[model samples]
Target: MTDTQAVQTPDNVAPVLVVDFGAQYAQLIARRVREARIYSEVIPHSATVDEIKAKNPAALILSGGPASVYAEDAPSIDPALMDLGVPVFGICYGYQCMAAALGGEVANTGGREFGRTPLRVTETDSVLLAGQPAEQPVWMSHNDAVQRAPEGFTVTASTEGAPVAAFENLERQMAGVQYHPEVIHTPHGQQVLTHFLYDIAGLEPTWTAANIAETLIDQVREQVGENGLAICGLSGGVDSAVAAALVQRAIGDRLTCVFVDHGLLRAGEREQVQNDFVAATGARLVTVDAAETFLTELKGVSDPETKRKIIGREFIRSFEGAVSEVLGDRAASGQKVDYLVQGTLYPDVVESGGGTGTANIKSHHNVGGLPEDLEFELVEPLRLLFKDEVRAVGRELGLPEEIVGRQPFPGPGLAIRIVGSVDAERLATLRKADLIAREELSSAGLDSTIWQCPVVLLADVRSVGVQGDGRTYGHPIVLRPVSSEDAMTADWTRVPYDVLEKISTRITNEVAEVNRVVLDVTSKPPGTIEWE
Candidate 1:
């Protein structure tokens, strides 16, 4: 295949097309599909029939939305998609749309199901509900329901709220559920979805991280050729570490990882990368201590975007310097470093408007804030993978658990964690508070449960509080602990009260800069995971 064609086609990658019907569960469905080791992508409902067919998806999934089918301008699917011969599965609002499109009766049922309901299975021989319990609890949220199945479809399941809760057209390989199988509240939800993906659609689960790593290594080898040199920006996070390791496996000693210490990282992050990563991957690493340079540039800057731009610029400069040093005599001998490896993930790409129908949330430093006239060709091996997938790949590459299990940290590091100016004293205070939060969370056995707890320093805001002896004015630290399937959306994690108390007491007593500790109970809708 030509380079352009090869870039378009991923070998052995089976993509499941998720048509978003404006539902919150759309991303959840995508994550569940990836958890099943099947690659999936989300497209807008506005996509044409030709656009849908262009993807050549192994299966199609219609996600639930909030729109009613009877309402004007409600999201609707093309009637011709049912005849495309691809196996299709619909959930919630998707189920209503498919039913109305395929000559089924759908109307406003007086009974509106909002929570868990008992499902009665009438057909065990159906492939969609095979090996599932006859009476199962399913999470539902809908006002209208399907009253009849489409022609050639067998009504296999029902609920009190709707008579035709689930249906299957075996011959055409079509299935749908009135409730979301992507939700965890439904106990057998994943099993039902897996049945549709594997048994009904006949798709193989071959999208493991190990397989992805192998393919990326080959691609990197092919792109770099025999004698080219590449440099990876190692940020001590899972993505960068895994990306650097994979590139090292591809080009051996030709890959030199440049780690720029920008004075905004958490405690001991640099040493972790220097000792653990180097020992694990055996890749040549160059550590540049440019903390003073970065802090000097960011002396009085308090705006998050401006800080990000300065950090990105300084990072590129540091990376260029490292490249020059690594290329010492080789550049004079006509050899050049032409590749810059990054660990940019799918969420980063999607959040940055790199995906179809996705909104631009914020600009990630590595992905969107880079210098336009940079010299190196970008090599992002994990660009299409998610955070959990990156962790799996890191483990598959035999990286230490410390590196593989490390939580996601921003490219701008602790500078963004502080809600105000970026400085040495503020950095130190926030770092101490953050370390205490990390320690207590880990001690309370909540490390893996909570994604990443960002102890934010509200340097611009201070409150009055009575300490042990007298009144004190100090910065308040905001503890943002979130739980998420992916970083795209998150819900606040309810940490135990005891654990919270300990974190609060320790931060106030140990680090004197802060007088109060507040928990951020906001979810991702109104508030992002990060404070700034």
Candidate 2:
């Protein structure tokens, strides 16, 4: 059956299933699966064979984790799943799991391999290595190695340190690889993954943003049928904007977008949301000016989590008020709005323990902190997509580059950037400094080179400096420039001296209240992109 037919068959039918073993790259694996144009979902490794079988997956992928196969509490695969008829591919610790569960031995070799490694395919007849060269560079990160293959499995490839680097069981259509093919460190990772998905598993590479849009439109039509109006919350970010546009395409005039200007946004942000979004999608929009409400709630709050909670509570009230206004107008015409759409993405779901049922990290307002007693059914169109894929879909739906390619902005806005309490004066000072930094970065043609350059203001701290041959005390603003593949982990970008000089000069000269401009040289592990 075709992919669409497979999805339509039942909830049990997914083209691919990724078994997440608490790996940081588990989310990346899901992304790769969708890249292959086949629907995939993440389930915990603790899931039983019957549970996996109920999903009716065409193939199974085991994700790599930090744990060693020799650990006492290491994750294991179900023997029943191995006996199942579906094709299976194991990666890293997953390969060891397969070996240990199938009468093979895994031993810690006292030698750990990390990062990029080379593998040699001794046997080219194996289906997994059919089109690949005899020797290729692959990524490896493991402390244990499989000493032997299970009954019917044969070694297909090996590295200098690893003997069972690659193995296959053609009769069962099962394979395992010690290296990580999902990471970019491996040169031909995607190519290898595509080979298995298309050649070995026989999946079609028909997945594209256009196909996703079309399928979702049909599903939305069936779910809402006729005469059901949907309300969308537009954050002016790419996710929300794209979600709004897609829903508009699905139901046309029946969709209403609510844009909240929380007074906490950067310079020109509100106007961009008001003019650019409406011009691009032609959807009916209700712009709510809740700047006063946000500022009022954030009067004396300084703690980051406290500020987040207060702002979140106020936002919900403001949005509910907007929804009520829409309903009040619709009530005059005897129409009822039944859905509330959000721009939640796949990472949000995965981070919320869609796989392992772990506690979610409470960093954002939208993830799992929504009020449970709401009245409208949730509509998350972008829940199955990544950030880049969302951008692609936005382009396919004809959204403006300003709306589609805009960098990610936190919902808390400047409140989080200011280390202490927030007010009009502090926010204005930060905005001015931030604008200078952004202007200089764009002028240097480095906008796309960095993920985001957050200009932070130390509102409570002041530094001594000389201006016009006099001692002056003013707050210092910090420039945080980071480079990232996904927002999960990031590294500080080494900005050129010329670019830094230009930014520093502009911020110090134009912004009168600021005396100094400092650069943040910390990475994501020790410090997040934002100070708060």
Candidate 3:
């Protein structure tokens, strides 16, 4: 799940609010909560207590951060959170914060406890660990430890290194754990989280994608009624495709998909969206060829953000034109198009800050790209789901594997992969290199191991190398093979040396105008998925 899904607040579902303490795992907590079939949201630690209370969350979770309680700028829990009358769960730094807020002591232990640690549950009778074994393995990554519990709190579990690993206050319905339960390294993490949600907080697990589709379809039927016509913006990508499929399922003949074939798309992308999407979903699709228009607008533009904005603007124009044509034709037949459907997922909404009305990371063409004077009401059926869940729902709806399981491609497509200005020559060069990398990776059975292997072309930079006993001056292609739980944050995957060698050798030998191949080892904090 990306940060978008991490903070998505599904309609009519009771939400669990996760207070962000600048922890990397803040989103993980939200993902876990959603995985438990409960909706959740995340807010920055700087958010005021009143702001948090206004969300009316079913429960509260404080995320762990890399901070010591004694530090000057450490994140602290809001006192108002305690009086909100909702169950609260704290992890790591959050655990320390809870202890300190309730008059406990937190000491900085010079010796750090990182990675997997055996946690022994001394009191398994507690609601959080009700049906669990006495001793279990839990993941721990912390430098500070809680020395004592606050008043009315009892130590429920502990490890050899930390004395107060787990503590609970039944009267306040509050609990804290030093170890992180959000990570997969913790064997029983999900079980403990489920216990807290169902056994302690009394929340029901009913947040399935099927239930969401059923509920949204009813709402769509009511809003659109019998005479309403809807136009869906279908990007060949999974999010948009899934959204279109769901909306079509909701309002069959009333829905029309507008797909813009920007020349920046990967090889065979346009055909897939044009032919495969219609064949799979049977939704009426309108294809707009804006390749020349996009290329014309992107001319002479080298800045990454500028290219993104230009592409977004041009895409909207093309889509609007298609919608107008479809609407005009329908109007001649006495039908009207009143709703514009977008496959805007929760990540796009949350990252764009659509949920809390805050400034988003950047303006997305689909989510934040709406015109002020637009007339159509918005219909986003897949807005409540994560990408993986969206794929599952698409499969459940009988979408083909090629359409449902396609890897994520950025909106800018190969334009972002080309280092400098995006032109036909540069895009072609990058496409060839990218295709070679993908083919080789798939041939070597490394496709599933790596989330995405972005093949980047350094158009402006050239290196001299010997090929066929002659010196050749050509640009190098960088292979960024990253492993991620969600696209929000990622780490470089450790591809086998033999596989890497094959990818390197093939890209240099087969793909012309390329001399060298390198790998990106950086993570998301340092580098985004796309290298611009």
* lDDT tens digits by residue: candidate 3, 1-532: 2344334455566688888777776767888998898877777877777877666788888889888878998768777678778898989988888888878989976646899888888885687877777888898988888888888888999887788899887777788799999988998888878877877788899877677667666766776777788888788888788878777777787788888888887777887789888988888788888889999988888877677778766766776677667775676777667787777776666656665433456555566555555667777776656677787778877889988777788777787788888889988888888877778788888767887888899888999988999999998999899887566568888988888898789888987789899988998856777786
- Give the alpha carbon lDDT tens digit for every residue of 202-307 in model 1: 8899888778889888888988889989999999888899999889999988999999999999997888879988888888888999999999998999987778
Question: For model 1, what is the error of residue 458's alpha carbon versus the real structure, in angstroms, after optimal superposition?
Answer: 1.3
Model 2: per-residue Cα lDDT over 1-532, one tens digit each: 1122112322323558788787877667767777777777667787788877877888999888878876778777777788788988888888888878788878887766888888898887877877788889999988888878888898989987788898888777778898998877887777777777877777876657887777666666666667788888888888889988878887888888988788888998888888988999888889899988889889888887778777766666677787767776678887777887778776655544443443354445555445556666667777667777788889998888988888888767888999889998899999988888888899998888998888899998999988888888999999999997656567899999999999998888888888898999998655767887
The candidate that achieves the highest lDDT relative to the unseen native structure = 1
lDDT of each: 0.86, 0.79, 0.79
Which prediction has the highest TM-score against the true structure?
Answer: 1
Summing lDDT over every window of 10 consecutive residues in candidate 1, give the lowest-scoring window: 1-10
Tell me the TM-score of each prediction against the true structure: 0.91, 0.91, 0.88
After TM-score superposition, the amount by which residue 204's alpha carbon in candidate 3 deviates from its true location, in angstroms, is 2.4
Query: Per-residue lDDT for 320 in model 1?
Result: 86
Measured with C-alpha atoms, the lDDT of residue 162 in candidate 3 is: 84
Q: Model 1 TM-score?
A: 0.91
Candidate 2 wrong stretches, greater than 4 Å: 1-13, 131-133, 333-335, 352-359, 460-462, 489-491, 521-528
